[model samples]
Target: MIERSVRGEAVWIRLDRPAKMNALHLDGWRELYGELDRASEEARVAVITGTEEAFCAGDDIETLDAMESADDVSELAVELRRVLFGIEELPVPVIAAVNGLAYGGGCEIVAASDLAVAVEDATFALPETRIGAYPPYAVERMAELVGKKRSMELALTGEPIDAETALEWGLVNRVVPRSELTDAVSAFVDDVVRSPKESIRLTKRHALAGKPSTGDEDRIAGALARASLSEECRDATQTFLEGGGSEEE
Candidate 1:
């Protein structure tokens, strides 16, 4: 579910499940957290990207639909927070190298990363509402990055914005042609690692200090559990899995 390698002063983590457009299940999320943990120990910078035409499509709808109890939903929410918060608390900067679509939880990952670079063809959205669900982590993170109004526009509308629009909204740092993506990411990595490692760590810590807290995971998990078990979500998910509804976000 994840591929990790050390490239010079950076560690590159790639999502490897192209068959599902790299959508993550529980095991995949756990694997990602392990990679991030390893990156903190091994590299000065970390870059996350996906294979082929996808960066990540987000959590697997099948997994979400199969969540049978409040405990399952709560565990999912807790694990999601661990990964997202792990990115923030890591000693080195984490860069999301977006190659294609980023939707739902995928978009939340972009928002949580310290910085991001994207191919010109990449797209982003918080389309959970279309499935009668919502992204637990993205609400506060998107509001922090793009403000409440714009964030609401995304979460409520379930529409995708282009790479250029993401840049304009402050979700990504740079957008380049697909061919230039590797070089673009390498350039950022080089610039970041040139600074002393401790300084970089301290800078990230100080920067995060200014951000508003989103409270505890319990509240977030409860909201998701309620939504996931709702009649609307169950009906929407069933329709989607049967291929009779819109594409899974």
Candidate 2:
């Protein structure tokens, strides 16, 4: 589940499903979209974090396995795209306070955020390829932050990168001790809110002005649908479900 709270001028959103490593299902995505909407209206800055030890493991594996067709996959992709794009289009800056592991879609969330702060022990990865699926948003947008070579390395290898490495690659702005993660994020929020809200909003708007159009969302979603419905994806997901591999979730 996604939880939201107000803290003066900032809104805090927590990914709260430790048992599944904070993996989100469709309802979670919808709730997150609603929370982002609320944040846009009510706060000058927003922060996304995780409860317990995980930032988010990714989309729930069981939910992915349950999809019976490409349309089912496409539906979930569209819903996810709404939240990811919503993060990008939000009037105020969004900060990802990554507390622990951020894998697959979770990493995508970090990429989409305006800024990110991660704990020293936090790990990030786009391991979707291991299960025969792919990270739609990460593939398309991560290069803007981390460069094409780094992004390709992540998506192609399906390997996890530590917080220090993530910072070096420009995936996150700061890396602090676990105990200091909240304070670090608070400091960033303070810095952001120090500016006039309209100035901050306009700065973000102008920064995004010449960015590539995301009209390829549908095309990307279609590719994801094909990947998710392939026999390779089904077989790999089943193997993982049957204890053939070990991961955060």
Clashes of each: 0, 0
TM-score of each: 0.96, 0.96
RMSD of each: 1.3, 1.4
After TM-score superposition, the amount by which residue 85's alpha carbon in candidate 1 deviates from its true location, in angstroms, is: 2.3
Candidate 2 residue lDDT tens string, 114-233: 999999999999989988888888877899899999999999999899999999999999999999998999999999999998898888888879988873667877888888888998
Which segments of model 1 are wrong by more than 4 Å?
244-249
Candidate models: Cα lDDT each: 0.88, 0.88
Q: For model 1, how does the per-residue alpha-carbon lDDT over 1-249 read when each residue is reduced to its tens digit?
A: 898888999999999989888898888888898899889998999999999989988888988899889899898888888888778889999999999989887888899999899999999988888778887777767788888998999999989999999999999999999999999999999999889999999999998898777736999889888898899999988888898532445
